[model samples]
Target: MPSLTAVCRVHALLDDSGSVGVTAIDKRPVDGPVEVKRLGVRGDVQASRAHHGGPDKAVYAYADSDAEHFAGILGYEVTPGLFGENLRVDGLDVTGAVIGERWAVGETLVLQVTMPRTPCATFARRLGESGWVKRFQAEGRPGAYLSIVKAGPIRAGDPIEVVSRPAHGVTIGDVFAGLEPEQASKLLASPAPRLSEIVHGLAEKALTRAAVGA
Candidate 1:
């Protein structure tokens, strides 16, 4: 069954003047239940509200399998929260999950898949890998960012249920890269709520460019 292997939270606030002035990208696995609020997990703060956090991106969820794939390429053990994910899920098609999909985590917390993460300069610096952003973008495995639909407590080893999936067929991976104009049209036409503004804007741009070129 799909479940949360690790529930992580901001472990430290490190200087990242290049992007956000200060960063809270050092997420570490936390013991016990962590309260998930409307904006994000409790005790966690986003460094850049302009680009990183808000109601649309309350929590970031990554597939552990995807992390393992990166581990193979990076030549290092990819631990839970190493990529700054609040929840490391296993046995789930995270990137393939359609936008507006709703996940029932543990008991009460409900989250809706909203958008795919875009790697930042701080993320690259945190990874200590040269050409990391391009590399990450090329691989196109950026995890899904979810909006908190129902705030509650979440802990490690909690069960994750994909309670709903929209028929739009716009997966997190598709939105991240390799999106065609038709797919972009479908995404924009989706009636499901809580889709992020970034995603909507991307679809609009792609559709408009396609229309102009036609």
Candidate 2:
């Protein structure tokens, strides 16, 4: 099977909350090719960190991962647009994926697509674009949340592969779709262990409450 490769990895910085520019965090820009940098696990990007974007957050570009056939989702398409993703993956059809699905990137990192990324107020306000959150909710294409199994540096041209599938048949999309406290708990309590202990504990509490109600 063909593997997913990283086409572009972009990091944006904000100057005191307004000026947003894409730059190389590590290596310098070279002739025709932007120098891809070696970003550490939790190094801070001044602009991004100042703007509240995670230090390790990066936008990744993938060649193919969209299931929609007719029209490609346009930039400014969803709430955050093409540039909103911390890691933009071209070949990952992660929109409707389930929990416990394992993906391997370049043999150095293993990430379990744990949950769907919800739109936060910061995202809406930062973008300052109208209908941002509504657009993403309408399409139900929320990107997946990654819990890093193995930490390592990633650059452009890295490949992504699906090493394992979720046994429960529920997708990551299902986990986030109208996920009430009870449902979230059930998913976490399932045979397949949750990727994050924090999430698992939250689920357990929710399950306890649900049991009390029952």
Candidate 3:
């Protein structure tokens, strides 16, 4: 069982040099319990709704182990929330987390794993590193994005409970690596109650693309 080591948030603001004209990628640690809602954590903002936020990506979680891996490579201390994650969890195999897996945060909040965080140019600019997106992809430890299944409050040091795990066995990393039609089909056909319709649609899209050799 993993523990929530830190909670973080940031306001949306303009970044002239970023790939995205504006971003909320500069998150910092927040103390005490914070409200969790359908859209996202209270006070947290996403400048680009199309690529971030909404029901499917309400919360982003990254494992401390993953951060440490980056820190070793980047040659700097990569603290919690530095990567714009809402939660910094310790001992969670974020890359290996299966899609549709549900985790209970503290006593109330329920979150379902949805997808992996795809590195973009905005992330690169935040790190002030060139080819960072490519480097991150090669590292293959993209964190997990979660959807609020049951809204409540979450705080640092909260214990995480695995309420359910989908049997599909497709991990967040698998999706990041680009799922094949067969792999996508298995996930779409899963009996997991936490699996969202949006995920099904994505699997269908992948199947279509595979069929067309796209």
lDDT of 3 by residue, 1-214 (tens): 7899999999457574644578898888888889999988899998778788889899999999999999999999999888999999997899999998999999899999998898988888888898999999999999999998899998999999888887778999988888888889999777765565566777888999998986
Instruction: Give the lowest summed-lDDT range of ten residues in model 2.
Output: 24-33
Each candidate's lDDT (Cα)?
0.89, 0.49, 0.88
**What is the C-alpha local distance difference test score of candidate 1?**
0.89
Q: Write the per-residue lDDT of candidate 1 for residues 56-166, one digit (tens) a residue.
A: 988999998999999999999999889989899999988899899999999999999999999988889999999999999998899989999999999988999999889
- lDDT, residue 2, candidate 1: 94
Q: Which ranges in model 1 have alpha carbons more than 4 Å from their true place?
A: none
Clashing pairs in 1: none
Shift of residue 92 alpha carbon in model 2, Å? 2.2
List of clashing residue pairs for candidate 2: 58-86, 60-88, 62-90, 64-91, 97-171, 97-172, 98-171, 98-172
Better of 2 and 3 by TM-score: 3
Clashes of each: 0, 8, 0
Over the stretch 1-214, how does candidate 2's per-residue lDDT look in tens digits? 4343332322344333324444222211112222223332333243445433331223222123442320354432221123344454555677655566776776476666666666654455554667767765666666665666666655445577888876555565555455566566557657774545534655666667777988
Segments in model 3 whose C-alpha atoms lie over 4 Å from true places: 11-14, 18-20, 194-202, 209-214
- Sorted by TM-score, highest first, which candidate order results? 1, 3, 2
Candidate 1 worst ten-residue window by lDDT: 188-197
Error of 3 at 186 (Å): 0.4
lDDT of 2 at 77: 29
